[model samples]
Target chain A: MTSVEHSPLTRKLSAFVALTKAELAVLDRLHKRRRIFRAGHDMVHQGQSAQTAFILYEGWVCSYKLQADGTRQIVDVQVPGDFLGLRSVLLRTSDHSFEPIVDIEAVEVRASDLLEAFAQTPRLATAILWAASRDEAMVVEHLVGIGRRDADVRMAHFLLELGARLALVGMGRAEGFDCPLTQYHLADTLGLSAVHVNRTLRQLRERGLVTFRDGHVRFHDHQGLVDLAEFDPAYLDQTGPLLT
Target chain B: MTSVEHSPLTRKLSAFVALTKAELAVLDRLHKRRRIFRAGHDMVHQGQSAQTAFILYEGWVCSYKLQADGTRQIVDVQVPGDFLGLRSVLLRTSDHSFEPIVDIEAVEVRASDLLEAFAQTPRLATAILWAASRDEAMVVEHLVGIGRRDADVRMAHFLLELGARLALVGMGRAEGFDCPLTQYHLADTLGLSAVHVNRTLRQLRERGLVTFRDGHVRFHDHQGLVDLAEFDPAYLDQTGPLLT
Candidate 1:
């Protein structure tokens, strides 16, 4: 419960809304009960009653649904500072399961405690709603990419998006980031096969647009990738007022 | 502003939380401006500043994103009782556009007025949050379907979900529902070509588990179709308590 002014969650929330010192202290205190999970660990399972919300302090996690045919669809990827299970606080049970993509550390916050904080500070509630709305917008954009875009465009868009999101928290440069995802993870997220993902990555490499190697992706030509993918960051809604 | 107790919006809110008589009156007054649009009309366009929210009183509308290449991705289909632009009120501009699939009647509620209502009634605010959470959950499920399921299972799951949602507002039965979407709409929503959608429909008809023709769908064997699709309604969160 020490000073969390420089924490990733603080940085994320400050981007949207300015919080009072007391408010930050409250949030820091609320985000307690630190836990760690190894890669491939199910942080939460589908059909499970949602009792806790987690804030990723480090590493990556994915929320996905497993089909009857044993295939997985990664609905979303969580980076540092992203709040997991915010929506689950309002629902009875989780609709999708969550798994750690790599070794991870997270703080478990009680849903009731978070709701109480919302009641105490309406601005925090609005910020949470804004975050949720942006999440929905990103999901919609991902749907468009998966539904219409070719593998090349999809991979480019995905890489550019990851770079931008990581940059928001000062984690990556404009053209590159430390990507921990494998071809299988990309396949699950982009609705492509592992082979297709590999081929798409090769095509991008051949075109001199991007490179994915050693768990990192570096864009040689960011604008070219953006143009090829028709990637627009407006859907992220990062420029909106924090409190409205 | 007269008695809206039995209105679709009222029913929708009631399903989540109990509303007092005074709250109902306030909601009725807020939902004052009524408007109508024909099929294929865009109710809200991308990049538009969302100043108002709309409640679909009748007919169907879809929120979609139209790519530069002219392909459309229907992100969500709205039936009666669904609130539009709840998220838009928080964001600067809409990321996706909305269009009506059939002639639609909607009641316009000012975003400022809705905010006022939320400030006055904390329970109403929680209910709205709950509704928004459910919307996000549905979008995530749709993502899973598009990303993982094949054409047949996807179609079956889509139809059953529509039937269940329509049944919520007393618009359809367990075994049948009036469907206004064309094969083109189905194709756009499911990420398939129009020809593929047609072929899939034919396959389902040939299987004798479901019949969709002339804007109507009858499930001859509801359980059979459900089993085939592995459709589960828990993601819809329809059975949760109306109020926390």
Candidate 2:
């Protein structure tokens, strides 16, 4: 927590917003009470009333919604610098569950503390709002992929988007970075069957566009994947006033 | 525009956050520069760089993301009181398009004006942010429905949600409400084939759960449909802090 410059959250927000020194210090101050939850256990459940969220510092987590039919849809995957259960802080109950992909580090954030931060630094508040809007846009993009894009395009877009997001936080680059999502995870995310996900991954590998295998995503032809996925990172990196 | 007491935006946000008279006045003041938009035309197209949003005063509009393959996914169907393109004002370029379902009345909003309003009334700003969070939750719910729920449940949940949303605006009720969407729109929203949407509607009607026909949604067995859809509206109506 000492190296504010090394903070992925700071780096991500700073991409679009220039934070003042005091704002960076205030952001640094929010890193108290770091906690770790073991992988394979949900830290939050749907309908669980709460007013706390987490700022991920390491590892990966996913938010998912479970259905009455015993099936679950992975809504979003969280990485370092991402906020987990942020919407829950504003709403009475958490509408989804979060399961860590690995034993990870995070800082618990109270709603009051966040509001106090907003009061102290309006610019920081706007930057955080921009971050939230960016997260919402990513979900919207995912919804579009699920509703309209074919499996190939969907997989390609998902991977490329993740890569771009990670790059902003210094966790990944075009050649790719480590990944932990299994085929089942891909199935739940892409709205495809596990078999379908498996086939799609094989197809992408055959096409030499991207590869998601054994805890990594290696981009063979990043440009080719981008073209096929129609990937546009403008929403993620827009220089709109709030975004700035 | 004088009916501050009857403004649907006010009504919807007031359900979650009580607005003082001053907040209401500020909200009312945002309604200048009223304009009319025709149906069957896009006021906002995907990737358009802009800084203006609109507050819908009347009629329905749908936002959609088009794919390279000529197919489009209807992301959200907005009604009176909804802020169309609000997200676009934050992100430099809109990632989707907006098409009015009918001739509509709306007020234009610029980014700077909105920021000024937020600065004037922080509580009101929180309320509006609550509204945005509610919208994001709806999309997440739709993502879950499309990824995990069966066709019948998806359709039932979607219709019930729309009904609940419209009810807040005093435009709908428990028994039924007028709708302008076609089977094709349902297909896009639910990520199903149009034939599948048709079959599901027929099935629900035959089962006496609900009926969506000829531009209307009638709740034949409202409770039964809710049971079928497993609709828990906590996310939409949470009593959390920002909500208050």
Best-performing candidate as measured by DockQ = 1
lDDT of candidate 1 over A1-244, digit per residue (tens): 3566777777777776778877787777877678889999798898888756788889999988888778888888999888787666667777878899899998887756765666566566666666777778878777888888899998898888888778777798976999899899999999999999999999899999999999989989998999999988876766634453
Find the 10 residues in a row with the least total lDDT in model 1 chain B: B235-244
B-chain TM-score of model 2: 0.96
Query: For every model in order, what is the number of clashing pairs?
Result: 3, 0
Specify the poorest-scoring 10-residue window by lDDT in model 1 chain A.
A235-244
Kindly report which residue stretches of model 1 are placed more than 4 angstroms away from their true locations once superposed: A20-26, A240-244, B20-26, B240-244
Model 2, position B150, has a per-residue lDDT of 86
lDDT of each: 0.81, 0.84
Which ranges of candidate 2 are over 4 A from the true structure?
Answer: A3-5, A238-244, B3-5, B238-244
Q: Which CAPRI quality tier does the interface of model 2 achieve?
A: medium
User: TM-score of chain B, per candidate?
Assistant: 0.95, 0.96
